[model samples]
Target: MNSSLSLEDFIASEKASLSEAMQMIDKNTHGIVFISDEKGVLIASLTDGDVRRYLLSGGAMNCRAIEAANNAPKSALSQKEAKKIFHKRDYVVIPIVDKKGRIVDIYTGDPKEQKLFRESLNVPVVINAGGKGSRLYPLTKVLPKPLIPVGDLPILELIMKSYLYNGCADFHIIVNYKKDLIKTYFRENEAHYNIRWYDENEPLGTGGGLSLLKKEIHETFFFANCDVLLDSNYAEILKFHKEHHNVITMVCAYKNFNIPYGVVEIGKDGVIQEMKEKPLISYLTNTGIYVVEPEVLDDIQDNISIGFPDIIEYERSKGRRTAVYPVRGNDWMDMGQFPELEKMRVRLSSE
Candidate 1:
């Protein structure tokens, strides 16, 4: 459990034989300690799993453990870069190298490195999962859209995980269509979340659902759609919203478009000024995520289907500040249809 395994000692030298590599692993529980050469150059690594996999792959115990290293990711600019790429995959382990691509160190991405310190937190979160998901068609016939599975978990689970990863846990799920299925699923599972449900009773537009929570909330909380997933720093977004003193903060993802056919730029009448083929364009789009203050909730009429945006428009009329946080397209996904579901499944499985 040594989180500080140094790569300088575990890596074998260029001339060192396989026998020396085995001794190093034996001393450090087989690659838990970082491996590096005498000149402090990183070369290759052996992990406990590597040993197991090697043996399972028909490798004998006598075989040099160094041979198990699958071309260690070489670090060029810095050691951290190599660590990130190598650890991004299964059995996170890393090899650090210099500008010359010679291994400078070895690292194991300990799970502890991913831990986040809990700060003084008090904000609540509202998740809008009430949609009937008519876009999903036949699939929605039997299950609520939020309850629909994406990979081994539901789309909603991934959404919550993204939020939870940033240390925001309080939640309120808005439900209406197939409320039983939503309730039943949560009841049967052992999820340690402080959650409450607000039923719309009838179909409500996205903005209208937040209107139902006026009575239960009074502070700032993030409002998110269950159908979309966004990987972002919630705490940073909340801080930006507060520092900017904005009433509403929208999280947007930048999407790029490239037209395959020639595109023309014309002026006034029908004169073509110029033409560009496969031009790349970018746009900031609604990511279905938001940071809202409690004051906006008060504008909703009791039991009304008015959603959060309705309040945004109302407040905007009074010159309220509305802002947006832009993220990369890779950080967001919308799975409201069969085609998108297929894409999501493939993407998740690949990850």
Candidate 2:
């Protein structure tokens, strides 16, 4: 057990805003924060999952921190008891409180403990690797985008290994551009990947390729673009998709942009309705990662060019259930462009 973090870092006031608690959780890197009264008596525990669920349920971020917290959190009276509780359950961190219910220290297990506690989701993954990466230019001229190295491993390999870590071994890869090199590289690699390759005779836009897997995929699976990587919990995403009974779950990332200059809202006939100085704008962006149902693929026409977003819209128009699962802005990484490629490289290398 590690108690290196100061108590203040782990404890948030009961009166604190949900945004403040979220910031504290991000700073702690433990994915949780303790809500305590002014006297430091623990009242509840808030986790990243809690915040996500709160937002999904339409709770406002400006609300009190305790509003999104688990009021009945498991706590221990001593370090020994905390350790036992931590080992016996999936608790990421446990708070040790005095007889008066005042928190003294927190028991955060080893750094690697987080990985050990991740629940495995044995699902199939479909990757769209057929794009002719125009943005990548010269690099694409020589190598496929998926074959480009992020660190020591190819980006496609990194994407596969991520799913592999979560117990997903079945990979259905759709390849077209520079297909020979992609196949040869995997053929020679030492790692034995259970991949089912599908070739597109003509260029098929992102969603078009799914038609090839119409008969193959009979259950829920992951559909992703080759140039993006997501750090969110796949198991939790799957759970949300299943619980909501959604035909498609688009994994979106929260992107925040700050306007450097003052912004004005215009009403009728050049009338200014509202004005703010240097406002911050936040929105959820599609990360090109999705938890998809097999039935959706049946609607995709074969040998046709269509984007995934269009497919989503077509499904939505038909009154099908489609939802969005949001993740932090930094959790989604795109290597489709030059600058982002370098950023992804640095990010993966550091990891």
Candidate 3:
């Protein structure tokens, strides 16, 4: 276990802002953070999932991180003890504290040591990489959006590996704009991906391209946008879909945005019923990811431009079961827009 990281690197004050805590968590990249009081005594612990659940449960993002921190965090008094707990629990990271409950060091399990126990999921993943990526503009003008580098790998590779890590091997990629560049890149690299490419003769909107896969895929499969990545267990989502008997499971993110000013709710007579300060709002936004049973493919009209959302609605209208699987806020990262792309670049580069 490496103890090179100073306690300051992983410790945050109880009063620290949620945003600050998130940055620390991101910098740590260990999925866990320690929270302490002014006296430098450990008070609580926060994981990326905890912060996300807080926000999803109406906790303000700008509020203190302590609001979401776990007061009864699992910890050990010494490094030796911590190691035992870590191995027994298979925890990714553990914090060590002294007699006074002040964090002295941190212990992290080596990922390399866990390869033999890795769980592999045998599911087909479909990536919609056909969009022009107009949001990225000049950058997309030269390199296709999916090929644009994030850290060392392109966005598409990251999306693929997220699934591959969970045992997914086969892939079906739908491409249209700058299709040749994508095919050529994959051809030259000859990466480990078992890729099958479907070129859209014309820009068939998101769901329309699925018509090409009606014959190709028969089982439940993952469908995702090339520009988004979810830092989550793919197998859990699949299990949820199967257990619930959903025809389609839409993966969503719990997003929180604050209203800049007070807003009033009007009554029937146009009189104000209630008013709120710069209140924070939260909602489950679709992350453009789905686990779909092949039967849903029948709703997609052949070669017609229909967005995925429309397809979902069409399925619902036909009495198909659809459900939403919500992931933490930090778990979902979108690189489709300019600002988000830049943020994702910095975050990925750090990793």
Candidate 4:
């Protein structure tokens, strides 16, 4: 059983808002929280997956947490029973409830036994590594952006390993800027990665390069930029894409910004309708990662500079499905610029 967190940290009131439960889940880093009634009786359990599903179904964030929770969550009477349940099922956490139906403790199994629980997805990965990386100017002058080291490993290697962990081995890399250096680096490295290289004669935008591989990839695959790292479950993302029957699913991160001053809204007659101080706003930002279907590549024009978002819009115009998968803000990291490079290095090193 995990003891690092207090019982209160694992429990939320039934009347708490969904957003508050989400914040608690994020703080615990366990992706779950237990909901209790006013008398401290267990009512339901909520996870990040549940919240995501609720949001995708058009549920409001201000709704009660119980509205999006599982009312019949599994519970155990003892830690030993919880351990057995953990081994028998795929559950990560179990609540220990007393005869009165109040939660006494939580069981998370042994720390060492907490491995990544994901079904192996042996899919192909396409990496866009041809960018000039003008933001990292001086470093890009000496070494290709893909070759820049985050810790001991290059950024490209880190990106590959993330997919490889989810059982993806086949890689198709499109290179143009400093292509020779990138190719040579992989050639010299001892780690055997199943990578195929493609070259572009002229500078092609992110989506345009996909035209080069028009008929090569016949199945669904993951496409991502070289400089961004998403600390998320790749298998879950793939599952969402396939289950929703979407042609393209863009991975987006929720970023929250706080205003420094009071904000006021005016009415038609110059009357102040509403005023608030230092409001926090949340929005989703694209993380340069996507789950794409093979046929989408056929829509790209050869040698045309078009962004991936433009391709999504074009597909949407044709009545094809395109959607977004939301992830937490800290789960997405970008090393495209100098300051973010150092931050990425620190984040990866601590891991």
Go through the candidates in order and give the C-alpha RMSD of each one to the true structure.
14.6, 3.2, 4.4, 2.5
Where does the lowest 10-residue lDDT sum fall in candidate 4? Answer: 111-120
Full ranking by lDDT: 2, 4, 3, 1
**Model 3: pairs clashing at backbone N, Cα or C within 3 Å:** 120-167, 121-167
Q: Per TM-score, what order, best first?
A: 4, 2, 3, 1
Evaluate residue 328 in candidate 1 and report its C-alpha lDDT on the 0 to 100 scale: 47
- CA deviation > 4 Å runs, candidate 2: 1-9, 13-16, 37-41, 97-104, 111-120, 257-280
What TM-score, over all chains together, does every model reach?
0.68, 0.86, 0.78, 0.89
Whichever of 1 and 3 has more lDDT, that candidate is 3
Cα lDDT, all candidates: 0.69, 0.88, 0.85, 0.88
lDDT-superior candidate, 2 or 3: 2
lDDT of 2 by residue, 32-120 (tens): 89999998898999987887888889987668889999999999998889888987886889999999999998888656545643567
Off by over 4 Å in 3: 1-73, 95-118, 262-276
The positional error of residue 256 in candidate 4, measured at the CA in angstroms, is 3.1
Off by over 4 Å in 4: 1-8, 38-40, 98-104, 114-117
Q: How far out, in Å, is residue 300 in model 1?
A: 1.8
lDDT of 3 at 293: 97
Better of 1 and 2 by lDDT: 2
